[model samples]
Target chain A: MATHLILRKILDTGFVSEPPPAADPALRTREQDLQEEILKVFGQALTVRHVDAGSCNGCELEIHALQGAHYNIEGIGVKFAASPRHADVLLVTGPVSRNLEVALKRTYEATPEPKWVVAVGECGCNGGLFGESYASCGRVANVIPVDVEVPGCPPTPVALLQGILAAVSR
Target chain B: MRIGDNEWPLEQRPGCTPVWRGRVPAERLPALAHDVRGCGGQLTALWGSDDRHLGGGFAIHVAFGIPQGTAWVSSDLGAEAPAYPDLSAVFPQADRMQRAAFDLLGIVASGAVDARRWLRHGAWPEDAWPLRRDFDAATRFEPTLDAYPFIQVEGDGVHEIPVGPIHAGTIEPGHFRFSVIGDRILKLEERLGYTHKGIEKRFEGMTAEEGARLAGRVSGDSHVAFAWACCMALESAAGSPPPARAQWLRALFLERERVANHLGDLGYLGNDVAFGIGFMQFWRLKEEWLRLNARLFGHRYLFDRVVPGGVACDLPAGAQAALTDQCDVVAMHVRQLKEIYDEHAGIQDRFVATGIVKPELAARLGLTGLAGRASGQAVDARVDAPCPPYDQVKVAIVTHDHGDVAARAEVRFGEVFESLRLIQELVRRMPAGPLLAELPTAAAGAEGLGRVEGWRGEVLVALRMGADGRLERVHAHDPSWQNWPVMEPGVLGNIVPDFPLINKSFNLSYSGQDL
Candidate 1:
């Protein structure tokens, strides 16, 4: 009975199969054209793999938001890969902690070449509040080569999308 | 009569809990701990201070929260004899705290079973104690990627599976070593501190105002809690309480924070259990709530909103009415989704009877806050020790006897509804006054304790103001400290694939615990 009720409620709510609104009109055209262009170039959708170096989990929260219905990153030609070997972009957050420095390096190496790194927070860009200490190695660039940097305590989901687009475009 | 046997003078501090200011002989410290344990006391926190500048020796402070009230037991350990009697025999959780104290401040707990460094992992030299007065903050040490010796389970069938310090998913760095035989986990040992950024050392010499900002960043998810607690500690130390209006606003912020996190967690739990539809609906609701937070407060995460003396911003004229309407709509949607979650048989199969932590085990492990409540430990700081607005408003403590993943999810669902109710009441009874109060400079050597019921659990901050109104020491203790260890037992007996589900059920903060 409860299952039937749930099905009825879901039916009442209706489907939201359409993609979210684009942040910019120019970007929308680029995204639409890039979908086929990316397929032609990469042979598949752009796959992103996220790595949390030592974030406060602030950036991680916003990153999770990107997958929500409001900003379905998959709706646009992007999917989050589970492994670094399968990923085209490495999204790293937090000030690189000393203990995590080697691990971050190893993760970067694991990803196949022609990969782009996007440092995705204030900490990721310039070590936000936790600057280079004995325990921290400052920013993501200090450890690995970063192609794009999204700057916010936690950059919004739209900014993250832009960062992904910027990386893939390059 | 605990200290009556020895004529130790107990003095009341202006802004702190009752304190036994005078030192106890190193030999007599264990006896006092035993006596406190006999009277059913729980060890809240254990920390060491480098008092060499004020005196010739370091001081070890252990705080005990009992049925009566909170009390601090301080004992002096001379420079030559830095070892103090370990309380691990009496209280099991003291094992890690003692190790942390030894690692940071060079205060040794002589009889503690585990002497391994808890927070230190070759980030600094073995001789360099960061919390010590002589340790310079600017000194940079060469990075040494030294291997940590995790306790290995050696057997013919016990093959180890080493998970990441850098995980594939968007999670903070923490290494999990699992010893398994055919998918059944024999043991799971966690190696955290990968996110330790020397926050305690960074807090030194900061003004009280600046320290509040640092506290908020201690764990971004519990930003409001940590900031409010830090502010409470500073204000208490200065003997100045914030205005009633500010107190109500703080409560408002806290409830909103609670609702946001619980909603987000419900969505995540659903996603983990393969209910993608539920995940979308719940996350959609959470996004709407967060958008409202951005409209009300400036930031999406509400960082730096809670400041010393009062909140940085106040609600606008029409904001309350709008928020009230939003809450009603959110509540209706939440009820609808929760029904779906409850009715789903597949979700129940994954959630129920999985990650079960018995009430007895939870109690023995010193579990606190929300996870504890789910497991029937039933300790909520807001209800137990009401502060300001909570004193005026009632909080319904939710508890479940079955300590499983389903129970934890149930607790989250219940808490979301309670928070919604609280928000409605708080917004309706909005107080009017100046948002910010002028805080007086705290006296040198003055210490204060701030305990707030954060969304996750109790967020505690201990602050001591140095001369010239600078921070002498500030230790922000997250409830994750107590909860993380218990997560090990919760995952036991469950298959390795269910690890993520169990892990998400507890959802302890790696950065919070590491800091």
Candidate 2:
């Protein structure tokens, strides 16, 4: 995990200096550097389609936040495509709701081959607080194939950007 | 059968009684429906509430609205079994609404077609309505699927495309069944209720104040609307008016909530049309605004800040000023984004003339809120049935002549300015006094209706007191119920790719409808 840096550095520091590269080519940025580096291995431009099985909109807010100027995932060639057919990455959120399970499966089915599924919240990963909801089938992974899991009550925008970048790099 | 103003049979009505009182007979339902339809009223919400406290009987409440006033009709069924007349024959959209009523309350809509379970799965026994009074809160059940009969769309080259209750993004659950030929959608059917939180069933025995708190959580984004409606019902039942300051505070919060969701949705709609840059810019500004919500209101989504009687916490003087400054910043940024969106021809091409819903169709379908307004069905509760602070201040409603994806987008953008203006006016004219007053002891058998304008549209809540002076049952209806079914017609003639932009333009709340 990246070290906690409060707003003081962002608000107070006049300018930022890049951190030095790690001793190894892999395991360099923070947790799982090798995983992060692998995202860059697949050079083809990536398009992501986002699906919400039944999110509280907490993670949706942050996932949407990644497009903001501060994070700017688009600058790194990560784009949100409207339909799964054009997507290389299928970004899923929320616990899998019984009502939405079939729709989620179809969304994946619509996407072309060589697609990767990324579960994008604690609920998506493991159903979180609403885990026991009768309407919720289970976690997103239980209903679909998830290659990368982004965990947090709501992962911060920076964390989401890092996760997406990691996927593209891999 | 005609009563004062509303035509309801006096005899055979659910008299105000202890335990479970005030339930109308099931036989009177068809008359009530005919009366409302004759008056050109719309079925606002239809859901069942548990009356386990009154024994095993569960009550189903049907609320309808005219231009200004709202009428409520409720019936009680056995604790083990409940039934209601089907309105889908009159109101085509009531099919799913009735299924939802069946899912939680276990009420069977007699002679109702398309009886697929709305929220309940094979996980729970059919005899067990999760929203029933005796259902254990901690009980866990696995999902079980029954036969879901999909209506076949037949023709040359016609095929079915079934989508999820589980999706790729962080959104509520719903299934999209499309019968398409080529890229053209011949018919589109949506199956929702995956996020049914059992909100109505959970309200059993809770004090009015406690129930209002849970109401706010129904859909996190529309906190003010749900909270205000619940509080209004409680206040009306208790005959306690919120303090002047609380009313003003509620107005401010409501406007902020409206602006924030509209902003986020507008950005996503634009993004769906392939306007990536527009999405990035608008969403960035929206995030900054929400961060300010966290600062000024405590929670990022402004959850729990709105409680019954009044707000849970008062705003510090500094926080008020900070909110004003942020509004100014957002206004400036929004104007810039608007310019880009308006001038971008490619984006405009994709949005304009797609998902066209004629004005007459909108009225017949009972469309409410922005979707209704875009199609010229102007029925904002804040304007018609003014309450509290809104009654004191004039609410400017924005309407559009064309009811298409573009019109919806334009309506939302226009509301952005109106909401910001409302925020400024509210802050400058905030009244002095306490936020809340002591709630009155609600009389047994008293009934009250609460209507608030949520960002999506008008949110209506109705409550009836039992003979024991507790909430017999309550109905919280989101505008989505009226709008979700309309998406089918809206997507017709438009290509499949255009559906996303059109869908985002509507941005209906699934949880709101599911509950």
Candidate 3:
């Protein structure tokens, strides 16, 4: 029964609401309000599309880990979609490359409005070591309007989850 | 250097005396060049560096075609500019490589017309060549990223669809301009070089051992391949051969890397075709495989495990046994998944003829690895150009005439089985020896070429020693450099929706190519 529930949860799309856990009294009011608003709107269900303007795949590994057995993001209602159109939020990683600028723009255009773009990684926020290349186009902000930036060499999976929840609240 | 069956006279290719002290002849140039062209060869890499100890001459390195042995064409570009007759007229794929040779090494190609600067923009001074003998690694240069000339796609019916250097999903960055007519793609232009981390420039002055680690990191996915190739080249230059046991371990790591990636690709391809279940399940499996890598090895991505002289990490006593058990689990699970995939009629329709790459066209563009092998180009660097432990083991090259998404997936399946078999054999006959030997101090002017069959295809690393035995300039070329061009032609008639499927079929590494 647990396995079936886990499988069902893993297979769930961004449609139904999930039961909320008890909130921590230590959390700020705004944080609680944000969580409530996000659960109310997205209902613990979301599909994410990852975009690589240009990345080293370091962050992608962490993202992949979220969907793995240990963290099991599917249990919470987040899924990865192929096309940007089907995605509720765009998970952007890497410093945007010159070659990928136009493709990035078109992808954003194809995605329906009421969509959010979350930059996840130091490179995504600002072009880390790849900053001074002739073919580079700086950070994610240089090319597209980013909603939230989750910074790390690659942000931890929980951080990514937090960022996703934050995006749905807005 | 083809002396007899498989062995060749090393460092005896065209134009001059051998730099190393081994008395290798320099007379075998013309026939070597001819042998490559006869097979409709593609020039994979062109790199050069200066060395002073062996003889103090600038050495140019060139790797020709898919591995069953490509000619290693090298020469000393004396005070005057080094020039080579254009191979682009013979092999159209040589155009970018030749331009890269000129752009990076300052080697002037006599007959080449299109000399656009690739991977070099206003960072280094006009005359300052980064790969040269006199180049300094400590020097910092600020580059201006203004006024790049992106080609315009013009027509009444044509609409431009620009896709990222940055998009959703945590993948490498590259820009693609699709000139589409309605839903059909007319012209697809690619602009790359966003993540130029100065990898090549960073290798300067480092010991060959340290340099191998950097090479592996150049592209995260093919870490083993790149690291192995760098080690092979450096070892060859230093005359340091890894023990028979170490070779087997390297191959084992290399094959696991291959299998892990292929599984991920299969799942992603399914997702592209609207089968989210396959994507989720396969990705789950992929993550498990990565965790296994971390458990057995140190890194989840298997980085830093492969170093010069030999592998950095040795498998624990139970690790090999655990890997065997995991292999069985993977095979059984994959078989069940394959059954579902085969039963699904919709998947067949989507993958069958979507992005068909004709055999003749594949040959024309010099396609290789899985994409080329799928299209009837039976070239496996491991099988054809046997190296170390692979040299002893028999390998059956997998090929398919129908170069579609289905065929590519099938080839991947075949490789997974072969990888399992090889791993079983490696663990069973595991040898006892020091996993690594102390790297020899390379002389001032030694040059060597190392070729390893990386999971993606053939990975080539050419090394040249600088003054005091430090690295001069090392050129590492991934199979993506040859296959990325073919993506344009492969996707020519395919619909826009099928573009991702076709792109996934090739799965070229932008990080590997951009560096």
- Between which residue pairs do clashes occur in model 1? none
DockQ of 2: 0.23
* Model 2, docking class: incorrect
DockQ-derived CAPRI band for the predicted complex in model 3: acceptable
Model 1, span B204-308: residue lDDT tens: 999988899889989999999999989988998888888888888889999898998999889889889888877788888888888888888888878888888
Mark the regions of model 2 whose C-alpha exceeds 4 Å error after superposition. Answer: A1-51, A74-133, A136-170, B1-6, B9-24, B52-56, B78-81, B168-171, B205-210, B318-322, B325-329, B438-449, B463-474
Write down the C-alpha DockQ for each prediction: 0.64, 0.23, 0.25
Which residue window of length 10 is worst by lDDT in model 3 chain B? B13-22
| DockQ head-to-head 1 vs 2, winner | 1
Report the CA-based lDDT of candidate 1 relative to the real structure.
Answer: 0.82
Worst 10 residues of 2 chain B by lDDT: B12-21
Error of 3 at A145 (Å): 14
Per-residue lDDT tens digits of candidate 2, residues B4-89?
24645333212111011134787667666666677676777777777667555777777666543555667877766568778877
- Chain A TM-score values for every predicted structure, listed in order: 0.83, 0.74, 0.75
**What TM-score do all the candidates reach, one by one?**
0.94, 0.80, 0.80
Candidate 2 vs 3: which has more lDDT? 2
Model 3 Cα shift for residue A88 (angstroms): 11
